[model samples]
Target: MIVFFFWLSIFIIVYTYAGYPALLYLLGKACRKTKEYEDYEPSITLLIAAYNEEDFIRRKLDNSLNLDYPSEKLQILVVADGSTDKTAEIVQTYESRHVELCFQPQRQGKLAAIDRAMAFARGDIVLFSDANNIYEPGTLKSLVVPFSDPTVGGVSGAKHIIKDENTLGESEGLYWKYESFIKKQETRLGSCSGVSGEIFAIRRALYEPAPRHIINDDFYLAMRLLRRGYRIVYVPQARSFERTSYSKKDEIIRRKRINAGRYQALRYFRQIFPLKYPRLMWQVISHKVFRLLLPFAMIVAFLTNGLALVPGLSKGEPSILRLTFPFNWIIFSIQSLFYLLSVIGNISAGKQGKLVYLPTFLVNSNIASFQGFLQFIKGNETALWEKVKRADNGEQINA
Candidate 1:
């Protein structure tokens, strides 16, 4: 039973991180590339939800105004609900640029802000954006092209973490690159399971006001479209850039909140099961569900492997190396070394190369996920989210 559990845990970790992506790669090769997108220009409302984002709102409005899309066709709306700072004031200044501001005095959370703003949105497509998302000139054009296909219900653009001198920035940039690849592959396979909240668009008519408790609004919104039998694809060319989290600690806070919301969102996706939608079910389970179970699997693998190495020691074994020779010597050694490096990397906060960053990031992320699970169980997370600080005070680098 010990050996069985050890192997099962190892399998879960491997399949979640590696095997699933490999399988997607192989299956995606058989799927033909979609070339149905055209020079499509549908009326779009660029909705920016701002909550005390005074640091980023001005630049974000400027960026939005400079987009290559026709000004007449695009309606720039900034929803500053419960913002006590100069966010609403700054947005008001943009009124001369034909930018609209919808300010609600009470802080009802992001979903509520979006819901209220949607009522005044005068576009066929609603593009959800964050204050920190700096768009390239052609991003808007690329984003809507996929909508030319009637089946495509929503489209998510790629998010690039601007690489900085810090190791965290580099690792985060690499992580997003990996995610972008997976989204591309998933899009080719048919539908992407989720989207980046920073940049995604859905038909305005399909917008539904979710319950006040829906914490992971982006995933819930995207999946709701899928549940309605519409396809959501990844648009790699529609790129927006933002800096990394202010620090490792901030990253963990952000990740924990996201993961907690993901756990809470499981109930919303209950109907998208294997029997009704086999391919989608496989994708969601492999891509999203397995991640939620990973920390537990890691704990099981570590404990089981450690226990397997204890028998010889109980028999008064002399050398530490000789204790587990017949049992889990190799696996135990690898785990031990990996964790040692993780400890060192954590202390140093990833000052080293990919060798350290890989383990540091992997361990920290899993810990955050576990913390998020606990938060979800305890109902500690709320719909109103506090913003995580970004590196360099959320300044936009030239994309």
Candidate 2:
């Protein structure tokens, strides 16, 4: 039973990381005829929810106003949720005539803010954004063009993590690039796994109010549409330029928040795979669910592998213990060393631990997932959260 459990854990970890992506790559090869989307310009409400963002509010409004779209067709609205700082004042400057400001006296979290603002929204389409994430001049045009396809329910824009010399920034940029590729392939297969919250556009008619404590509003919105048999397309041409958190501490806070939401989603959206969506079910299981469960699998694998190393009174090694005793020990040693590096990486400054960025990133992210699991299990996770201080160059926007 020990060996059985050990190999099962190993298999799950391997399948979660390597095997699943490989399967997606093979499936991507069986492509279908591309559908040509015509130019589309629907009435748009650029909805951006801001907490205390006095530093970036002006720039955010500037970028929103400068998008290459007809001003008459687009209306920008900023939701200032319980902001006590100059954030509300700055936003109020552009109110009424240019941008509409929805003020909530008390902090009701992001979902509630959106619910209140949606009441005032008159657009045929709703485009969501983050305060610090700057959109490119052509993002609005690129985002809406896919709406021409009747089957495309919504579209997620590409997030271009700014190139910074810091290891944290570089790793984030690389991770996003990898995500973009996966999203592109998922769309090719049928639909994307979820939309980027920073820059996703949905038809206002299809928009449903998010639960008060929802963690990942973007994913919730997109999945709800997918359940109704609509494809969420990922458009790489439309872009939001963002910078990374200064260090793992900052990133972990954001990651913990996101993972907590993910756990909630796993339960709240349990019936994701209906009878008609076998392929989509496979994609969701492989892409999202497994990734969510990976941290637990890693813990189990580490524990079970250590148990397998105990003195074996039995003569030959079990087939499940495919690696020779010495080799197994070596692999465990390497893994131990990697984890040790992660510890050191966490303690030291990012520049000092630049060489171990990849290992540190993977370890910290998994650890954050575990933290999120705890938060979910304790029923302490909520939509309202303290935004971590970022690089000031439009740094982290909570996940």
Candidate 3:
């Protein structure tokens, strides 16, 4: 029994973090690349959903206007969902310049806002973006390129975390870099299970009105496309830049909301399991389900290792067992150190000058996941958007 538990813990951790990714890389490499279509220029509508984003609206609008796509083929729609601030005014300021401003006094939710915005969008493709993220100059062109393939129903752009002097900034940026690498590998395999909310493009024909209660509309929408036999491509060259959350507290709030969305997604997408969607089940399980359970797996590993350390529990075992005892201590010690660093990272985030606070960021994320899980169980998680403070060029916004 002890040996079974021990091996199980090891397998969970290794398969979740390392083995799965290795298998994905191998399988991705084995798949044949689809032929590229060159003469594909489809009309695109850029949809921006804003809620009390006064500070960043103008900049986002300016960036949208400057996108490299042909002006005639581009349409910009900004939906101000119950903003009691200057968000509506800022978007209205761009009305004369091909920007359509949609404002509703009642705030239903983000999905509702998106649905309302889509009604006004007239284009072959609809691209969704957040109000705070800034798209690179040629982001639209790169994002739309993958749609040349008729099977490609949706495309997700890479998120680029702008680096700053703060440790949180460094950790956030590094985490995104790692996520981007994994996304690329998953895309190469076939389709990534989810895409960044900041940037994703979908065919207008595939657009469906998401349930108003959906927390992660972007994820659900993209996954829905995949479920309908559409390919979801990851376009790395299409970039969206945004700052890390202002502080650890703010970051926690953001992550908790995201984790809650993950839980909700699991419940909604229960059909994409191992026995159900056999063809794409491996990708979905590896990319989405495993990630949601990783924190619990970490806890299981720690507890199982602790149990194995008790003297009488496995006494007089093989010499190999005794030799491996110290290794367990070392692993536990490292985990403790990581937690300590996370605490330090939280404390020193705004004040310190360090460039890498990986330990702090990682620990904080897990902590948020725990809180998010509790929220999910209590039915406290909602589709309501919670704003995170943003930093632009070293200055903090009231967001």
Best by lDDT: 1
User: What's the count of clashing pairs in each model shown?
Assistant: 0, 0, 1
Could you tell me every candidate's TM-score relative to the true structure? 0.94, 0.93, 0.92
- List lDDT for all candidates, in order: 0.86, 0.81, 0.79
lDDT of 3 at 338: 61
- Candidate 2 Cα misplacement greater than 4 A, ranges: 270-275, 313-323, 350-355, 393-399
- Of candidate 3, the 10-residue stretch with the lowest lDDT total is 314-323
Candidate 3 residue 296 Cα shift, in angstroms, is 1.5
Query: Ranking under lDDT, best-scoring first?
Result: 1, 2, 3
Q: What CA root-mean-square deviation does each model show from the true structure?
A: 3.1, 2.8, 3.0
Error of 3 at 114 (Å): 0.9
Give the alpha carbon lDDT tens digit for every residue of 49-155 in model 2: 89998988888898788788899998999999899889989988887658989997899889999999999888888999988888888888889988888888899
Question: By TM-score, how accurate is candidate 3?
Answer: 0.92
Q: Rank order by TM-score, top first? A: 1, 2, 3
lDDT score of residue 224 within candidate 2: 82
**Cα lDDT tens digits for candidate 3, 170-231:** 87887788778777887786677669988999999889887788898887887778777888
Question: How big is the positional error of residue 85 in model 2, measured in Å on the Cα after superposition?
Answer: 0.7
